[model samples]
Target: MTTAIAGRIEIVSDAICPWCWIGKAHLDGALELLAAEGLAFGLGWLPFQLNPDMPEGGVDRRAYRTEKFGSWERSQQMDAQVADAGRVAGVEFRHDRMARTPNTVEAHRLIRLAGVDGVQHATMDRVFRAYFNEGQDIGDRAVLGALGREAGMAAPTLEAFAAGDAARAEVVAESRALAQAGINGVPSVLLDRHLLFSGAMPAERMADGIRRAVAILRDRAA
Candidate 1:
């Protein structure tokens, strides 16, 4: 069966970004509204590492966040703020369960592979849930392989993909390119090469942006 797509949407984000997850949910809501209007899109998940210099295994979440945020109390407050926003987006954030902030390069590479397997959305969702809600270590190869398997990918294929560096350099390069392009944030969404708004915007606002982008794209084509 073939699906009729109006255009392609590329979302540049990191695997461990809570705001990116919330942005995805809002984007899903926007798509649902657009679907009712007979509009559809193909999604592309791009890589943007929030912590590209972190160690391979990663550091303790409390220690890392404390140092980054200036104190444990400040970090908790920030997490609470994000949690409150997440609740409005229908996302469950288990910040209390999150212990370690894992390096997400491997996870980003897997997302690239998932795109080829036609399960990128599901794989991204799985990674988000694993890190945010389930508090699982996304940097672990075994866990990533299991996530791929759950997303309908073959275990053997995932194992081989994990054992070597296939999309590693590509992911890093893409992330660097995005940074060089002056996009230093996650959840930077682009539709048909037209950059939409950034941040976890409301569904209605997102829909409006998409509508405007579609109109501009059609005008350009015309």
Candidate 2:
């Protein structure tokens, strides 16, 4: 049997993190670019809650950002930066439609459970779009269930799973462990658990990292 490269790409991010969304787009583009170069690798999503302490009902986004960034003006600047990047990634970020800053624990939980059905990417993409584009509340069970359906998951099963606390603890624990590992930002890319760079990186940079990772795996296999 021919040996294949044995490494996976893990993207550590939160749904509400605009940069992560943009970074994911870049990652997708990078992966496609590498695929054209005859490199294909597995992709995984590692959960990270942007607001672990958010209220169950979430907080007013305007108030949250104004306070978190120390001023609304500064928050606008950050949003504008992301908006510019989003344009490059083809993601039209609807910050104006965003009302609440949700506790993304449930959203992460949805991704975790979605992984079991082998639609993790589709499910995660839907969640990101629902929040960042459609301005939908992803923290809600109904919304998550609907997204699961969109991702080809069985509706009743997804509903039951989302309505319960399955995978919630594991998601939180994994995110906590990731923080303990000294990574404090979203859009962090890892090749076989080896940290590459944090935040949204350029597509060429991601492709280079993937290419290098594949080379290392091939050497080890040989």
Candidate 3:
């Protein structure tokens, strides 16, 4: 009988990044496939804000992209690619419905809270679904509160947590740490704190990467 190997996979990303959504979908597919194949792995989500200093009320997506990337054409092209990738992964990403790109500090904080609650995966999925599928303003307290409730988080607790600066400092600190670690982009997947896989890779490739990482961990344990 083959012994199950445990591995840690951390994904550093922002909620507003289209590529990050695609990468997440790919990772989800890979994990599901691996599980069906009897492979074992643990996943974690880390904070990385694409727009760390975005305005409190957020900025129009078109204006933000044009200013940051210098061209609407470039942004549209990238979005098209991301949409295609998401579709391939069985996710319906409604890019047209996304109006604004807000500072993801609060969203990251919620992820931190979810981690403490041991429901990080569910919370992250709710955030992604709210932003990408339902066209909800993830930066708003009401939307986040609903998302938290959906993820089985207590409403009052999450409300107080969001109202305060809880985990805000930690989220920002983690983002800074990721940047200092040479990750200047979203959708960076780190395996075992050593191997780095960037961008939205195919599900099969990610599964292979996870398998190799698990093997290394097993060997190290032995």
Encode model 2's per-residue lDDT on 1-222: one tens digit a residue: 333444788899998889988998899999878877766677789998767888987888999899989999999999888899899887899888888888888888888888777888888898899999899988788888888888887665687575688887899999999999987999898888989788777888888877887788678779
For each predicted model, how many residue pairs clash, with residues at least 3 apart or on different chains?
0, 0, 0
Please identify which of the two predictions, 1 or 3, would achieve the higher lDDT against the true structure.
Answer: 1
Roughly what TM-score does model 3 have, to 2 decimal places? 0.90
**What would the TM-scores of all predictions be?**
0.96, 0.93, 0.90
- lDDT (C-alpha, whole model) for all candidates: 0.89, 0.85, 0.81
Q: Cα deviation of 43 in candidate 1 (Å)? A: 0.5
Which candidate achieves the best TM-score against the true structure?
1
Q: Is candidate 1 or candidate 3 better by TM-score?
A: 1
lDDT of 3: 0.81
Ranking of models by TM-score: 1, 2, 3
Q: Number of clashing pairs, model 1? A: 0
lDDT by residue for model 1 (94-182), tens? 99899999999999989988877788888998889989999999999889889888987766568667789878999999999888988
**RMSD list, candidates in order:** 1.8, 2.2, 2.1
For model 3, residues 1-222, the per-residue Cα lDDT tens digits are: 343535678888888777777788888888877887777666788999877778988888889889878999998888887777788877788878989887788788888887766777788888998898878888887778778878987665687666888888988999998899899887898877765678888888988888777777778889
